[model samples]
Target chain A: EPEVTQTPSHQVTQMGQEVILRCVPISNHLYFYWYRQILGQKVEFLVSFYNNEISEKSEIFDDQFSVERPDGSNFTLKIRSTKLEDSAMYFCASSDDRGWETQYFGPGTRLLVL
Target chain B: SQQGEEDPQALSIQEGENATMNCSYKTSINNLQWYRQNSGRGLVHLILIRSNEREKHSGRLRVTLDTSKKSSSLLITASRAADTASYFCATDARNFNKFYFGSGTKLNVKP
Candidate 1:
């Protein structure tokens, strides 16, 4: 079974520094999404990407956040400047059909902004 | 505001017992999905129940959706220690591609 995979399983960065979390979603899947989970909080949607553009985003996805599909397989989330509150587990997911369909998720990247 | 919320934030049971988790949502949804996450890991898709469906099952996992009541339940029968993990319910609102997740229920199935 093909699965979504992410790089840099864990990262530690200083506040005010830029960070890029990378993911390679299921090859044939069309829709991609990014979500974050604070240590003890629910998963929060960040953004969804399709056709090289953002389809939907949450209020939490502010100007500091940007997503790019720089290549056919690589989808990345870039945080212009990290904040302490940004420490969380970031997961990348993809679905073969509509974004609402069942999505396969990657193991996640743990980002710690100190 | 959160779309889904789960009850019994934590549960502990012995192997071979059954575990049940309930989920409630605040809005009309197109579908509800259940996922599992190990400590510090990612979300794993478990099952999805559409608004029109009342119940669905896969292996030891059973899910029931009551659209009218805006509630759902997940049952894991004949559980094992490996079943210990946090379970979450995600709701997809009508015409929306995004999913709102619940706080999740942490299940610990002891050997």
Candidate 2:
């Protein structure tokens, strides 16, 4: 089965530096989402993208966060400034246009902000 | 924010036995989804039950959603050693397609 794939399975960055996480969603999917989980914590919604624009975003998706569908197949999340608290596993998921279809997740990018 | 809350944060069972996990939400939901994670890696989609549906089953896995009570349950029948993983319930936030996941239940099935 086709699945979402992310690049740079793990990243280590210093505080206040910029970091960009990349994802290649399923080719035919219409909606994409970004979520993050702190170690041993619940998964928190960050943002959702559709039609090459942000459709919905959570409060946790603050000024430092931005998402882009620069091309047809790539969805990227950029953090302008990393903080220690930003250390977590970032996941990318995608679903078809059919409302009933279930979302599939990628292996995830482990971001370690030092 | 996370709306679904699952109970029995951890469970251990012998292979061939059944494992059941429960979830409750604070608000109305369009659908409830279940996911499994092993060793803190990627999440694997298990099942999804719409608010209008009371029960659904896929192979040995069963899911039930009670919208009136705002609760749901996932049952893994005749479990195996590979069934050991953390199970989580997710619900979409109102008016948005953003999915919020609850604290997962860690299941350990010993062979």
lDDT per residue, candidate 2, B18-105, as tens digits? Answer: 9999999888888889999998699999998988899999999999999888899999999999999999999874544777689989
Q: In terms of lDDT, which candidate is strongest?
A: 1
Location of the lowest summed lDDT over 10 successive residues in candidate 2 chain A:
A95-104
**Tens digits of per-residue lDDT for model 2 on A11-66?**
99999999999999999999999999999999888998888888888889999999
Give the per-residue lDDT of model 1 (tens digit) for B1-111.
678899989999999999999999988899999999999998999999999999999999999999888999999999999999999999987745689999999999999
Q: Which numbered prediction scores highest in DockQ against the true structure?
A: 1
Q: Give the Cα-based TM-score of candidate 1 against the true structure.
A: 0.98
- List the candidate 2 regions with Cα displacement exceeding 4 Å: B93-96
> Interface Cα RMSD for candidate 2?
1.7
Poorest stretch of ten by lDDT in candidate 1 chain B? B91-100
Where is model 1 more than 4 Å wrong at Cα?
none
Q: Evaluated on chain B only, what are the TM-scores of all the candidate structures, in order?
A: 0.97, 0.95
In model 2, chain B matches the true chain B with a TM-score of: 0.95
- DockQ for every model, please: 0.82, 0.72
Report the Cα lDDT for candidate 1.
0.94
